[model samples]
Target: MIHILGKIFSIISIISLIFAIFTGNLSQLAGAMLDGASKAVTLTLALVGTMGFWSGVMCVLQDIGVCRLLAKVIAPILKFIFPENCKKGIATDEIAANISANMLGLGNAATPIGIQAMKALSKANGDDGTASDDMITFVVMNTCAVSLMPTTLIALRRAAGSANPFSILIPVWICSVVCAAVAVFFAKAFALFSHAGYKMKNARDSAPPKTRESKAGTE
Candidate 1:
């Protein structure tokens, strides 16, 4: 996928360059590129303090046992969503940490925690190449995670000179919840369908072969 995306981007860039040259807009394109690069750097620098502050807050929360408290609060819900993991008692802590980090809108912090959780889950699943139901569900949840405080987005808005940086809070909450719910629903539906198919295949494989006598009797 990464290779495919790289090729697509290269093709687009080549086409854009061709168009710019044909239209005698090469200088304009070059200027635009420089401007975009400058803006990217500026944005990165602006976000640095906000990101660092949130990261520090996350660490402080962990140190003060707030993360653990949040984990305990969400334990039942996690158990319900991840019965297999709960049964094995594997990856529970990592899963909780990942979820807590996401809720706090600490995506960068959540990423490493999420990776650890995935590793623990994969191990619990016997390290199978194929993703299990729990893995699919967890991935979906992580991708569409509900963020109670989208600090990164707020910081971007502020950097962009929004009159009210926090104005998106309500919309973000609604969108995240809806997205997470829909994603989980589809993941679960697919998992059930796959499980049913697997069972059918297993039953077919385990069934006894029809003998000549049985064929004759049926005829």
Candidate 2:
């Protein structure tokens, strides 16, 4: 997938360069590229401080046992969502940390925690090549996680000179909740279908084969 994406991007870049040359806009394109690079650097610098602050907050929360408290609060929900993993008490702590970080709008902090959770889940699954139901559910939840405080987004808005950076809070809450529900619904639906198919296949495979005499008798 990475290779395919790289090839697609290369093709697009080549096509754009050709178009720019044909239209005699090569200099303009070059200037635009430089301006975009400058903006990217500026944005990265602006986000650096916000990311650092959130990272520190995550550490402080952990040190103060807030993470554990939050984990305990959400334990029931996690158990419901990750029955298999929760049954064996696997990846629970990592999962809780990831969720907590996401809720706090610490995406950068959540990413590593999410990766650790995935690794724990994969290990518990015996390192199987295929993703398990729990992994799928986790991915869905992580991707569409609810953010009670979208600090990163607010920082970006502030950097962009928004009159009211926090104006998006309500909309973000609504959108995140809706997206998470929809994603979880689909993930669970697919898992249920997969399990049903597997059970049917197993039953068919375990059934006795019909003998020639039985076939004749039936006929």
Candidate 3:
């Protein structure tokens, strides 16, 4: 459905563009587009370099001990984040580590690790089981990440030949921080709800043989 909607939107945009051109509005549209492009070039250039550079750095980090170090740093938080998996299953560990790398703006580095993590989680949970809150949290957490450096934006800036390439640093930081906070809050909230339901069920099940209700038949 999303793909179809996207196609429809694209077709509409193309038709609009064609109509504008036929009606002698193409020059104005072109000028407006060029202005927007010019403004974005700086970010584009910065982004390209940062993404590639950080990606390589992350790969090297994995090859070395940096990724492990990061995993270690985040382990405590991960434990709290995934209360159900206290013992660090291979799948859980991989998922946490990959997510940590992605948080550092290393999506490329996270790919194989993420894949490995998913397979492990699936195997652990079984084929019939759906994704647990931990799994969903990991996925959501990755999407609205809080990046320390706006490498991609910087690359875009550089590509666009911005005189002041680092101008968007603060904006990126603020945006990322806000987005990450919201994502994490939602993830934890959902996890808490799920955990609470499990606890309620367990507590009810374990409540000492059900007192008067079960004894009524015997009486």
Candidate 4:
């Protein structure tokens, strides 16, 4: 689906550029492209410093084992939610660090840890890289993660010249909470539904077949 969308957008861009050239608006197109590129570069530069600072902070937390302490606090809840590996347990330290980065709204910092967690989850699945229930649950949690600080959003707002950059903090928290709740609810619901279906199928497969004698006796 993503590939298809990318192709569609690429074709649209090509067609639009062709149309602009035919209409003698090539100079306008060039100017617009240059302006967009400049803005993108400026935004990237502005974000780089903030991202680096947060990443370093998270790294320091990990080195100092603060992440492990946080992991210990949340381990029971994590184990409960992901029962597949309840016995073995997931890598709590990595997950906790990832969650911490997310809560701080350091998405760039969170991404590496999130990737590590995904790899750990994939190994726990014991499959050919196919996503398991725990993996799906983690994905849902990460997608709808609550951003308590939302530094990135605040930065964007500041760049846009908002009078109060952090004004949306409360709103962001509310939305994140609602989204995460719904995400977890649906993920669990689907997991239960699939498990029930598998059990029903297994029971049917294991049931004994009626013999001819039994059928005749019944008749």
Candidate 5:
């Protein structure tokens, strides 16, 4: 589906650019766009090379079991964020592993590990109707996660000829951390409300229901 959408968008963009050229209103602008794309070719290659280097380094770390060890260290933190798993006695080791990889700014490495972790979490939940609170919370937590190092962003900025590559580190850290914290807090708040409601419904259903005749006779 994503590939199909990409193909559609690519065709649309090519058609729009051709239409602009044919209309003659965008002659100079089109020329400038072409120049920019030409200039970006070298920068794009540099960025890809940097990313590839870092990704390879991450792979080496993974092979050496350093990443798994790091994951074990952070498992407690992950368990706190995903309490339903704790309640269900479902291990989140793979998730912890994936998160540790992400923390090191290796999102690609984290993905397959996370997918496996999700499968494990689902199986532990033992039902298919709705995802468990832990699963939802984990999704939210990962989606807005605070990255330790913006390695890819820094690499891209450098490739784009920035004067200082690491200049934005402090600001990025502050903003990403704040956003991650807010996201996790909201997820936890919603999970709490959902759990309370579920428990309330369960209690209401389990208790004896009052009948009109029984109440009248008691009165």
Candidate 6:
């Protein structure tokens, strides 16, 4: 679906470019594209700097075994969400770091660690390119992570000249908690339903076939 959307957008962009050229507005289009690209580059650089600093901090924490400690701390929850087989090792550490970064509102810093965790999960799932129950649950948690600091929002507000930059803190916290709880609840509920369905299917598949004598006796 996402690939299809990307292709659709690319086709629309090409058509717009052609129309602009035919209408002799190519220069204006080029200027707009250049301005957008320039702004994108600037934003990319800003994000890179932020990601670098936070990633370095995460690296230091990992070097000092903080990620491991955090993994241990969150082990029970992780075990409940993930498959019993994949609950240990670097995957758990990556998840811990990702969650830590998210709580601190350093989502850029969390991206790489989250990717690593997904890779670990894929490997655990036998590289089938299908999302497992644990993967789905992890995605739910990551998407709805409770942001305690929301530093990015605060910075954006400050940039926009807000008088009280941190005024959104309480609202952000409340919203994050509520949304995360709701997302987790639904994801777990679906996971349980899917597991039950699979178990029933397996049970039906393994049941004994009725013989001719058994069928006649039943009749």
What's the true lDDT of residue 120 in model 1?
83
* Candidate 5, 90-188: lDDT as tens digits: 657777877788777777778898888788878876758578766777788789866777877998889878999999999988998788778888988
Candidate 6 — which residues are off by over 4 angstroms? Answer: 1-76, 83-90, 195-219
User: Which residue pairs show backbone clashes in model 2?
Assistant: none
Q: Tens digit of lDDT per residue, candidate 6, span 1-219?
A: 999999998998899899998999988987888898887776665556555665576567657866456556666666555556444553876787787767765566788989998898889778888887667878899989887666556656665578998999999889987897788788989978986776566556665453433434523
- Predicted structure 5: lDDT: 0.77
Q: What lDDT would each prediction earn against the true structure?
A: 0.83, 0.83, 0.72, 0.76, 0.77, 0.73
lDDT at position 59, candidate 4: 69
The digit string of per-residue lDDT tens for model 3 on 1-219 reads 999999997997698799997999988877877787776775565566677777777677678877678778777776766666657554667866786777666776788888787777666666457886656776787777767666666766677688988988888879986887688789889878876776566557756456435444423
Q: Write the number of the candidate with greater TM-score, choosing between 1 and 4.
A: 1
Error of 3 at 144 (Å): 1.5
Comparing 3 with 6 on TM-score, the higher-scoring candidate is: 3
Among residues 3 or more apart in sequence or in different chains, the pairs in candidate 1 whose N, CA or C atoms overlap within 3 Å are none
Residues 1-219, candidate 4: write the lDDT tens digits.
999999997998899799998999988988988898899989987777766776677667667876556556666767767665666657555776777667766576678998898888888667576677777888898988887767667777777788998889999999997887788789999988987776566556655454433434533
Better of 4 and 6 by TM-score: 4
Model 6: how far residue 127 lies from native, Å: 1.6
lDDT of 1 by residue, 152-205 (tens): 888999999999999899999999888987888899999889867765665566
Candidate 4 deviant stretches above 4 angstroms: 1-12, 15-30, 52-66, 90-93, 105-116, 196-219
lDDT of 5 at 18: 87
